[model samples]
Target chain A: MSQLFQHLEPSDSHFEPDKDEVLNAIRWNADGLIPAIAQQYDSGEVLMMAWMNREALEKTLQSHRVCYWSRSRSTLWRKGESSGQVQKLKAMNLDCDGDTLLLQVDQEGPACHTGRRSCFYVRLEQNKAWVDQAPLIDPKTLYTNKP
Target chain B: MSQLFQHLEPSDSHFEPDKDEVLNAIRWNADGLIPAIAQQYDSGEVLMMAWMNREALEKTLQSHRVCYWSRSRSTLWRKGESSGQVQKLKAMNLDCDGDTLLLQVDQEGPACHTGRRSCFYVRLEQNKAWVDQAPLIDPKTLYTNKP
Candidate 1:
């Protein structure tokens, strides 16, 4: 356990849990990762979901930003390297058992790949039909010719 | 197990594992949910992460979309309902143990609340310095006076 992880319990109201405490407190699965939920700090809109390993968690804490582990290539991936949409970490919260994490970030751009502002752009009507709400951002403009 | 949950093998490549199979397959500690990673199907950008309970998992599968169990509100939530950034279900792949899920979604908007396309917007340089990559979108246009 690193000294950076030590902090107070978020539920205590008086106890402000630090990065280390939040990371170490969580019940990471055998894979050494935890589920992190990114939400709009003000509007309470969920942006997306990603995995966070110890190192990524630490980086997020130290930087006051959000970091996640990429399972596809099995590596540490920082957001916005190519797209430029960044998450500035404002506050981090842990679930009761420390199995999940909620990150309040200062987001920079759209949070989805389709060029919209969020990954969640579909809507289900009262009849249970799924409908597209908005047009996606043209990929060409978003990727900056990176392909 | 319901008929929907049957016929799902942890090793089946083509078949998207159902909620039961996903729960049974993963290495969940005591929590009923697993760590599911949401990514853009086309561009392969990482989005956000959230917990998937049995209901959320089933809902996502049934609707051919992404859903999650919100710990704070203790409810099953469909992505993009309020924000209009819906995750259209492209395909669902479970990790080896079924504890992790790779959701390839036709993302509509930004996956981050900060109006970025992906939740991963912050980047760390070689010197461990954090850098912001993604830009923020105008929320007024996105929400469009939907109070």
Candidate 2:
């Protein structure tokens, strides 16, 4: 794996993501994307999971905000930009395979578009039935003009 | 969003994932895969994140073992089967958009192949340096024999 390692070049962003040693350790998929999971910094509750391309990762490291690559939209999405549910990055970690990232974030507002505190609002019941573990706030309340 | 809800037919799964109502809500990617994050049941530490196809998710819910779809090998991976780092599913959750899964597990041994308790061992320091938050245990010590 070390043989495949390549370093990130310096970026103009305020944070020096290029200087971050493990940046080169990320093993991106053929699509040049990796899964990024966000967990609440204090509670350890997982807020949401999204995909990040190399640029998205770099921007996140520089901005200290969660940035995701919107596959459907093919654009860089700064979380909470439209919904006001911003996630401030507290820390980031790379999994063993270097294909996954765990981001500890200071979450503001609900992390779900459905108005849930965390995106994981449904659970499988013992009877194999799925039930809501949390209540949904009106989506309209989260999005100002709908992004 | 609840108005758009529907139910699933009964299945033989102990938890009745078919009865698990949110099955249809999941919006799997074009590849028919979703990212699943595993967290320690007691400590709240995120262990690792992996990809799970429909079959992998079904089997995991049925058998109570964490099963992942290995993109590299294109096979179903039963965690810790060879290394004895098995993850017993304690609870499972689906994100609001149904694109991701959160699993709470009772993990045995290290959850990372690198012989670390959690896969998130690397952290970015203030000076943009990557630091090891945990010590790595020799991989050979974890595996009885190469699987």
Most accurate candidate by DockQ: 2
lDDT (Cα, tens digit) per residue for candidate 2, span A11-55 = 111323333446666788778899899999999888888899988
lDDT of 1 at A71: 78
Off by over 4 Å in 1: A1-11, A16-22, A124-127, A145-147, B1-147
* lDDT tens readout by residue for model 1, B41-105: 77665566677887787688788868888777788777876678788887665432235555778
For candidate 1, lDDT tens digit of each residue in A30-138?
A: 8898777676676655566678998998888777767799877698877765677778886665543455666777777676555555543323221232223232455
Q: Which lDDT value does model 2 have at B65? A: 89
Among residues 3 or more apart in sequence or in different chains, the pairs in candidate 2 whose N, CA or C atoms overlap within 3 Å are: A128-B15, A128-B16, A128-B19, A128-B20, A129-B19, A129-B20, A130-B20, A130-B21
Predicted candidate 2 versus true structure: per-residue lDDT over B60-126, tens digit per residue:
8888988999877899999877787789999898765567889999998778776667777556533
Model 2 misplaced stretches (Cα beyond 4 Å): A2-21, A125-127, A145-147, B1-21, B125-127, B145-147
Q: After best superposition, candidate 2 residue B14: deviation in angstroms?
A: 19
